[model samples]
Target: MAGIYLRGKTWWGRVQKDGQDLRQSLETRSESVARGRLKVWLDELEALAWGGKPRLTVNAAMDEFQKEHGPTLRPSTVRRYGVSIDHLDAFLGDKLLLTVRSSDLKDFETARRTAGASAPTVRRDLACLSTVFGFAIEKEWADINPVIPFLRQRAKRGLRESPPRTRYLTRAEEARLIESALPYVADAILFAIYTGLRQEEQFSLTWEQVDLARKHVTISAETAKGKRERTVILLAPALAVLKRIPRHLKSPFVFHHGAATTTRGARRALPSASTKKDNDGERFNHLDRGLRNAAKRAKVPLLRWHDLRRTHGCRLLQEEKWTLEMVRDQLGHRSVVQTERSYAFLEVEDRRMAAHGPGTNPGTAAAQEIDNATGEPIAAQKPAQGRRTDLEKLKKSTA
Candidate 1:
């Protein structure tokens, strides 16, 4: 039996089930309204316990969701999602999916905070839960999404401030790094610098996509981040790097030796005959080790692989002739705003160059001194008295 009672001037719903007391705050002052709400809540609990079919647990649903949908995402994205799910599963081990309440979510948030997860990271985990629950609801596995309101609450808090932007390598550091990289890998780094292609894109580039006559590389829809096709024009330096690569009749990949597929699909393709397994494996291993060593040798601290792309974008914006649209196309960024914002530091460099006018040139300076007014060099004018004296003396002598 369950009934509403007054305790400390507040209504509370009290129920006795199997001789144990169950108490809940009714959150109402009116007796009739308290009774009605208590009845409804109890009915829902009873129905959930006795009338409903057995529901899948959170772990079960998450496993199914990942197995079915994980393959479709990019390798990097899939790896991140897998990590987030692993954290959640560890925190809420064996918790029933339908039984999760607002309190459980709040507890999870608290735990994550105590474990030193950033606000954005916690929010991402919550988003993942919301996605999983939404999928469950669509499949009739759960009645409602427990994570939706929490997601809305988190969104209201807004995104956390990201860490300060890291410093990129200057020209001197870049030159040193380029000089120190493994002989085979140096061209790859140079290609990344000239084209702003991501590591995955650089590794996946095929010779078929490159047109030397047109001086462009056509990235396929399958390889691009946006899943759209884009063409990148090659500068003279980029073309020179491309020309330096030794082409094989059988292999069409620009960077030869590895499987010629996307990152996600690379593991599936067997190594080609030309791919000397040991040498190629060691080279790939060296590429990873060599980049960091090169950065150290170059005395560049905290230099990441992605900074190559950033450097390229910044250089393009800093150049006097290149526009934002050109950068967007070159970087394969979906929007001009992305290129502008991400590479905004270049704007400062551009302004600095503009402040310093055209430099001194000896030829131009000499040319400007030849006055157009007299078509001769302007020398000091002769005194009028001297001219008059000379004219009078000339007249007297003639007389």
Candidate 2:
């Protein structure tokens, strides 16, 4: 038999079974409602003690899921997951794990959208929740993964078109950017352009990575974006930049700016630091600001810092005439598809040129007829006569 006591408006039960006393709270403001709820709760507890289902809270399940699978992810990936979970915890705190419905997820999606998160960003957060719940279902922590089905259907319908991707720096813009950057930053920019090294890779580059005699740079797995080791063949321009670097046998960094040493607590600090002028660590920001100012001064289009990398890829595609595979290897891309996706514009321009053929204009049919009658390519004819004049002068000078 069970004894029930009324505490305020709620009822609590105390039952003695097998020499053990068990307590259960019936959460209700009405004594009659609490009494009815307590009877059902006791039955459920008895069934659970004899191999029935046990309910879990959202917080407990998430904690369990994280403990089991969190270590497999990379540090950066783990940080991103933590951020997403924080948002979910804020919304669904105190809810039972199995009680969360698809409608709750939809409401959360709406709230996040109203708060100005992009669709892609929201999708990624939802993906984290979906994965967590999926794992919970696998572990028998929850009967169904509410986030999974919602994510699949919602993701397709809610997909937003991403921002336009930008690539490449125009010649004049490149020149102005180089001229404006501080000496060390200019060197770093040139290194990035020539080597196609990512910003983090450039920052963490060591003297060991460079082979001056071989004219190559070996990027380690830890520094590379793809998590794979690769080597970049350094051209003469890239080599020249490397040669100009003031090497210290003791210092490991390739570009150890004075600003970095002073502010970042490098062993050898810079002397006579200025409050107005940036130190070595802050020099990158100054260089970025300088580029913006230079773009304004030159009346050029706005360019991002990453435009240098795009310029490198575009130069390889256009000037060097490197194959897509070659560009992929040089840029350390994980897949050729990534390279093509990023630089397919170059291929489009090439195809357009090929379709029209060189020196032919659709708007100038008469000019094309004149060129056809001349029996010469329009661009080659002028250069040929100029070369003839130079050849005659050269023969006269030799005689």
**Each prediction's number of clashing residue pairs:** 0, 5
**TM per candidate:** 0.63, 0.62
**lDDT tens digits by residue: candidate 1, 140-167:** 6788888888767656675343554635
Enumerate residue pairs that collide in model 2: 259-279, 259-280, 259-281, 260-280, 260-281
Q: Which structure among the candidates has the greatest lDDT?
A: 1
Best by TM-score: 1
lDDT of 2: 0.67
Candidate 1 regions with alpha-carbon error over 4 angstroms: 1-54, 109-123, 137-167, 248-251, 256-287, 350-399
lDDT string for model 2 (1-399, tens) is: 677787776778777777889887766677778677667767767867886545666666778878987776545567788888888888875677778898988888888889898888778888888788788778766677777778778757964446546656645445555554445556777887888877667767777899999999999887676779999988777899889766655557776644221111224432233233433432132246545554454344566667777878887887688988999999999889999888877666666658987433222123222235667533211111112232344456555
Where is model 1 poorest over a 10-residue stretch in terms of lDDT?
A: 259-268
